[model samples]
Target: MAQLAQSITPVDAVVSRMRALDATLPERDGVAVFNRVYLAVTEEVDRHLDAGAFPDPEAAITLDVRFAERYLRVAEQGCPPACWRPLLQFRRHPGVRPLQFALAGINAHIGHDLALAVVDACRTLGCEPADLEDEFDRVGDLLISMEERIREDLMPGPDLLQIADPLTHLLGSWSLERARDATWSAARALWALRGLPDLAEEFCDRLDAAVGFAGRMLLTPLPD
Candidate 1:
């Protein structure tokens, strides 16, 4: 989409494609809100990659692209997992705040997509989760950093974020660190169940549903 050369790396391709999406989508659209947040993280990843931060660049690139592909596929199909469905359905709703959209997308991506992406990368690279741990941790750290920024940028002022504020309580309920830990555990579990496709599928489905439930809660419309 970016007219990238045939030789462009997978990571670059993913970044370029996201840039295109960011350019095309409406600013207030839910997908656009998430895209901006995600794009910032991806761009940071790209910077780190270029700076020789990742111990396994190839693995990092593969995992990053695979993870992003899950979300992109949903965008292309106009259909997404239960975890993502609520966000898409409410993308244009006026009651949903930008912060809600951003966090919901983050919930869906990190909670569900990251686990699957790890398995996908493992299969593609002929490696295991242990081998990708560094990449996973590095990416997770970037996400955590972005999460803080998202809150600071999208959250209401100090006075508005009072103890009784619903937004404050809502934001406090979800933790990116907790989600990252769970995703790592899920990836390990999924990898172990590779031989048992049925079990793995069930596990993934349950995860999707649970994540979707959280996302739906996060998207609860509030008074402006």
Candidate 2:
């Protein structure tokens, strides 16, 4: 069994870990509870991959990438960077580093196009003019961050072939399936909540983009 490096402590585990410590809940406070659940789910996903419990490794990689990209879109565009900081910190896990490598490889192929698409989608949504600039800011930040991390941190030795191959393999596995599930969930989440009809359409469009990207991993050439 591989020793796990990072994990969200279970509620029971936390209480046990702080056996002698006293803790109290604040009035109507749900933040701590939500935080614990979020961490637990993240660790569960990591451990699921670590344990090889996913039905297919190849599909898992694609799904993971799609989900991560979708997440980055939300983080850098919709949510404040500070809201994303903690999740980004999860990249410290070794399992996560490879996922970033895989993401970089995918972005190299479609980064510019998808980014422009996202920006266009923002306009269709009639986002505040300030928000349009914010999205661009987020995009620039991501590009810079990716450049710095891939070189200075993630892979000390540049081995594109090694990085790309495993990720490709994993994308063909169950990851893609999970990726599909995520998009479908996105469609569900956007129902009437996004406010703008055009924006909601674009939201589903992006979700379909995710699904279509995953389907490409199917290997059989589809003729136009």
Candidate 3:
């Protein structure tokens, strides 16, 4: 298990793990839904890396691997951060929409795990968050683009877009752009607090709780 975990650093290896997970999960499983979306995004990132799209491929790979490991951890172990609890807890609830599951997972990932991934990459590369800014922005751009596509593909048609539709309101309530910005801020803040472990832990706890609250809201079951 330790060896397998260590071997997950390569993008191809991580992609394989996600693919295997995708095969095992039912189509409607909340974790599977998010995993499918994430797998596509990661594949795209791999393509970008192969094409030399990132200014520093090593840094990009490190960050991407570190970021992905968090989600993979949740799949391997039932344990997850507070921000992810709602999605996993309500994975099969009939009232929850697929789009809600995807967005809630994204909220947990971007709002919590991403900041830590940045710090992880920085520590591994012996650099600061600022040094990886370009890679971060590019990766973030891809996630934002994927999110736009997810909305278009998962959002209900116009007939369901009436003013009274809760899905519409729910969709409006969350913004990937806002989440991305906040994650970047949180990453820098976390990096600054690395020297103070106690304070850092407190900040992380608060962030986990706050993001979890948002995710819980996102996963609210809607009426048919």
Name the top lDDT candidate: 3
In order, what lDDT does every prediction score? Answer: 0.89, 0.36, 0.89
State the lDDT of candidate 3 residue by residue for 1-224, as single tens digits. 01122223388888999999999999999999999999999999888877767777788888999999999999878789899999999999998888999999999999999999999999998999999899899999999888888988877778777623888788789999999899999999999999999999999999999999999999888887
lDDT of 2 by residue, 18-81 (tens): 2212133221122222223223333444455456554433333223333334433542354412
- lDDT tens readout by residue for model 1, 37-149: 99889889888877777777888888999999999888766768888999999999987888889999999999999999999999998998999999899999999977888
Q: What is the Å distance of residue 140 in model 1 from its true position?
A: 0.4
By TM-score: ranked, best first: 3, 1, 2
Give per-model TM-scores: 0.93, 0.26, 0.94
Better of 1 and 2 by TM-score: 1
Give the Cα-based TM-score of candidate 1 against the true structure.
0.93
Assess the local accuracy of residue 53 in candidate 1 as a C-alpha lDDT between 0 and 100. 77
Q: Candidate 1 has which clashing residue pairs, if any?
A: 83-212
Candidate numbers, best lDDT first, in rank order: 3, 1, 2
